[model samples]
Target: MRKKAVRNQLWVPIIAMTLLIAGCGTKTEPMVDTAAGSKQQQSASPAPAPQTPVETVELTISAAASLTDALKEIQTVYQTKATSTKLNFNFGASGALQQQIEQGAPADLFLSAATKNMKTLVDNQLIDAGKQKNLLTNELVVVVPVDSKVSIGSEADLSKPEVLHVAIGIPESVPAGSYAKEALTYGKLWDSLQSRMVQGKDVRQVLQYIETGNADAGFVYKTDALTSNKVKIAFAVDPKSYQAVEYPIGIVKSTKHGKEAEDFYNYLQSKEALDVFVKFGFTVPK
Candidate 1:
């Protein structure tokens, strides 16, 4: 009876040991599966999303040649502020630009040095009359080469014998030339100066003539004369001599980007743009 009792005690211990071993194996297998699942989830994480691009709109502006310097500065400011819109400028004589618009050239806006060109466009329905406004004013001036020795102090001096050739823009197309003609006519010197006049396609060309010494003197806007180191202002024509030198801006009737063009047009009247124009010798409209 003592031997049988000892055998029963040994069997109890063996059964307890077997049950513990089986529990450990089951728990370890589940732990290994859980660790593998965590690694797979980490490896399958998605990449960051791409950023959206900004939408950009481009506009074309047909402007008078005299606005070249001021508009270039304004363009820099506009681009910095209005990031979504880009301005492309087409600078030329207002009459030439008017003809181009009449011929169906692609332009979003028109900025004229004089109202006559604007009037022609308005008369032909090429511009939005409702959107038109005179933005600035300018003065007519006589310019001589930096090294000129002739005593030219007024429009009357342009007919002096020492002044061999005088440069002026074409009166039929360039507003500056038309103003020059009016000033000379007001002074009663038109016929006397006509024989010595050298005509250019635009005001810039007139300025170029004086700069290169191609002509003894030239007529240009005060703003145009201010841009050059090679020319000196010989005199400012009396305000009474010519009509008001007004600059008008308007939206084109055929512009596809009317909203953008209008926005830019309004921006030109802002203090920032006006400051630039003033720096370049343009006078703000009252």
Candidate 2:
């Protein structure tokens, strides 16, 4: 009976130990599987993509007022090729633009309506003379309001009594005005038409004077006249009467962004830029 009691105690201890070991094994298996699953998920995850930075550069241009339309279109078309570069334009009379540059107005490049203004800058050492190029030519013409009955078939007719008010740019600061002076002086009409003159700051303003009927006749570039439908070309001023109208473009020597300005200056000589300028009625140098 004593031996049987001792054997029963030993059996009870073995059964308790077996149950404890089985419980530990069941808990440990799930924990091991969960740890393995976490590592697998980490290893299988996709990597992040690399980053690419965009270039941020903006260029400024000081151009003749007549180039406004063509350059704007060039700016649009150039964006396809130069996606990171931006263009800012300062358009005004060529002489005025020249003065601004001489006075240190912010400009990366200069486009003048006349070679005379460009030569002045070149002489001032503000532009590299070697970099200057005459890119366009324009015809000076007489314009009238679309509804006018005036018969101005020639530059001589500008002195007619019936055409009382004639618009022109101010000669001291306007290249178009300087051209008109040259034409009238060539025809011996500049001295006679002064009392009836309506002056403008730029060719476009002269264009406005005709379009608004403030002046019975005005002289402007063919390109300027083409920009408006409210005015009609009464006649083309004889090319022999004035200096040939040329558009000279160059990069300013003081430009902060020389490379970008040069890229644009070069682009202006491209076929795409010529297309836009020709479409705007400017003559590209062959």
lDDT of 2 by residue, 102-214 (tens): 99988889999999899999999999988879999989999999999888898888778889899999988888999999998988888889899999998889999999889
lDDT of each: 0.93, 0.90
Per-model TM values vs. the true structure: 0.87, 0.85
User: Per-residue lDDT of 1-286 in model 1, one digit per residue for the tens?
Assistant: 9999999998998999999899888844334687888889888996678989988999999999999999998998889988999999999999999999999999999999999999889888988789899999999999999999999998877777899999999999999999989988998988988789999999999999999999999999999999999999998989999999999999999999989999999999889889999999999977
Cα lDDT, model 1, residue 96: 97
